[model samples]
Target: MQAQKFDLVSPEFKRNPFPVFSEMRSCGSIVQAKLPLIGRVWMATTYDAAVDMLRDHERFPQQAVRNGKKNVAGIKWWMPKALKVLTNNMLLQDEPDHRRLRGLVEQAFMQHSIEEFRPRIETIVDQFLDELELKFKQSGSVDLIEHFARPFPLAIICELMGLPDEDRPMFSRWAQGITNSGSIFSFLSMIPKLWKMNGYFTQQFKKCRVNPVPGLLSSLVSAEQDGHQLSEDELLAMAFLLLFAGHETTVHSLSGSVWTLLQHADQLEALQANWSNIDLAIEELLRFLTPVQMTKPRIAAMDMEFHGQPIQQGDYIIALLAAANCDPEKFDRPEVLNLLRDPNPHLAFGSGIHVCLGLKLARAEMAIALEKLFSRFPKLHLAVPEKELQWKKMLGLRSLLKLPVKLA
Candidate 1:
């Protein structure tokens, strides 16, 4: 089949993309396509294809080689140097470099470490719920994204990284300005925010070196493993990745989880009746929602035929995580949301070596957020009709612009 093109970032597509993905899957497991700002690429649409491409790093590496030069992701040759630095994170590396960078701070995100973080996350979640309660009482309604969803995870991630609480609001501003880079104009407009973020992170790094405060920043500053240490540029890249990924994705996950439950009153009631295994419910939501829609652009490592499609060296490929999660071959009634889906092998956090480092923490936060939310506000309902809800037009992320809710 010829390379296909579609508006993946359009509001219409953002609202419901499964049918489009289904069409793509019917054509082939891996179909060639074109994405804005990323150029022609292959999109892995099925569970098996997605897993194979993600695991076969040798054929499609995170780092790319073009014109005898190495580049990361789909970065253009003329893009600004600052943008390149931000994209040069561990998520876009391969092999030894990826392993070395990941090892530096892996301990803090381990399952045991995240488990210990439960009480603190609970405290934070409750605090946000309390604030939401006050706002709801005063106004009779609240935008969950503003009052709770966005700030809640941002606060947790900032605190976890030892950033000042006062700076939390600015991070959101920067994130909003830069999250959707589907167009060249939008991409260029975020340079200022990028500059500010880079400057702020640099100052924090210096402070850590001089005074050595607590949190991940301090640990990363002094962290060394096997005689390997992070350089200043790498430090900036790593910090950006963690801060953005740690909170931004969770913001959507939390908000989307609430929206999903509100849509399915039956599932909501079922969960409220028994909070014993809310983790199961959260997993199902993760699969059903699939917040981060696409994997980082992977470069074809060599010329080869993948599932009968001829792929040339330097071609780009992206695994559609949302599509893969809902592949009918993998899940029974993949379109339906089952709260108690056991053995749910969803790729929401992805698979292979580049799997999300914060999966455990994210899952914990979601579970806690859901449990505390419903327990406190069982009568909660949407303030506006579902059809009027808005989803951000950001590529590769499934985020709600706002989730207005009424607390009764």
Candidate 2:
């Protein structure tokens, strides 16, 4: 198959890449594309192909060859020191280090442990929505992203990390600064912001060390007593990863799911009327919206043929989950929202050994939030037309900048 030219950074494509993805999918299951900011890479747009690439980490490794000299030069001049502290986490690591780091953090996100937090999560959601209802009554408008989408995840993650409630607002600001979709230099500017975040977390870790709280951080600190403890740097990296991954992805998920539902009122009504199907609704939403559209860059360890296309070793490949989730071959009427979808094997959370460890937790959080949201505001509707909604371009993730909605 001939390679399809896909400019990942082109302004038009970034604004909405579905057309480009469809074009590529028409060409073949896998197609080579050159991305701006980065260079040549392969884009996979089929469900089976994406799942295969993600699952077979042995063939396609997570760690990319860092242009160390360039990175150092850039960091020295442009990057903030604190960002350097937080960027060295599991997301960027591979092999023994990645395995070690993930193992240490896995205990905190175990199924039972996440289930134990449900009541707390439910309480938090109730408070946020209740407050939103009041605000809606007063102003008749609310930015869902700010009022609920962002804070819901931020509060949950902070609580999970054992970070003090008083510091959450600061943490939220720092996180937004760091993850803002913009130029590399613009993003690098968030280094100092992240550094401040790291400082706060470090102090929190110390407090946990002295008077260990029963949170993820405290549990990680206690892991050392069992002989598999992480170094301070590793521990800090784990904490940073959990916070960023736990909250940011869910923020986008919440926003994207709502945006999608607004676009498909029939599905939204179906879900509200039959709350029992919320589980499937959540699954379909995760698949359809695919908030985490791109996976970490994967480098081919050896030359391999993916769906008849030759992929050379050392070449980078990005599994486009959003594209694959909507591939017609995998999903019937792929573009239309269907809450009743079954056999939905979407790679939204990813696949294989590196699959999102927080998958269950994220689902539970979204399901609970959506259930409460719809129940509390059955007359909820978008305050702005879909065209007026702005989407952040250039960010690795696709999310609405703001979702204006009114609680009736």
- Which has the greatest TM-score? 1
Candidate 1 lDDT: 0.87
Q: For model 2, how does the per-residue alpha-carbon lDDT over 166-279 read when each residue is reduced to its tens digit? A: 888887887788677366677657766766767877787789889988678888887742467888787787888888899999998988888777778888887888899998
Note each model's CA RMSD in angstroms.
1.6, 2.9
Which structure among the candidates has the greatest lDDT? 1
Model 2 regions lying over 4 Å from their true place: 1-17, 65-85, 224-226
**In angstroms, how far off is 108's CA in candidate 1?**
4.7
Pairs that collide in candidate 1 are: none
Give lDDT tens digits, candidate 1, residues 1-408: 688876677777777888887888898989988877777789999999999999998887887754223555445565678767876899988888898899887954442377677899999999999999999989989999999988999998898898999999999888877786667788888888888888999999999999987688888888888887789999999999999999889989999999999989998898899998798998999999999999998888788899878888888889999999999999999889899999899999999989999998899899988898889999999999999999888889988899999988
> lDDT of model 1 at residue 138?
94
Residue 388 displacement (Å), model 1: 0.5
Model 1 residue runs over 4 Å out of place are 66-76, 108-112
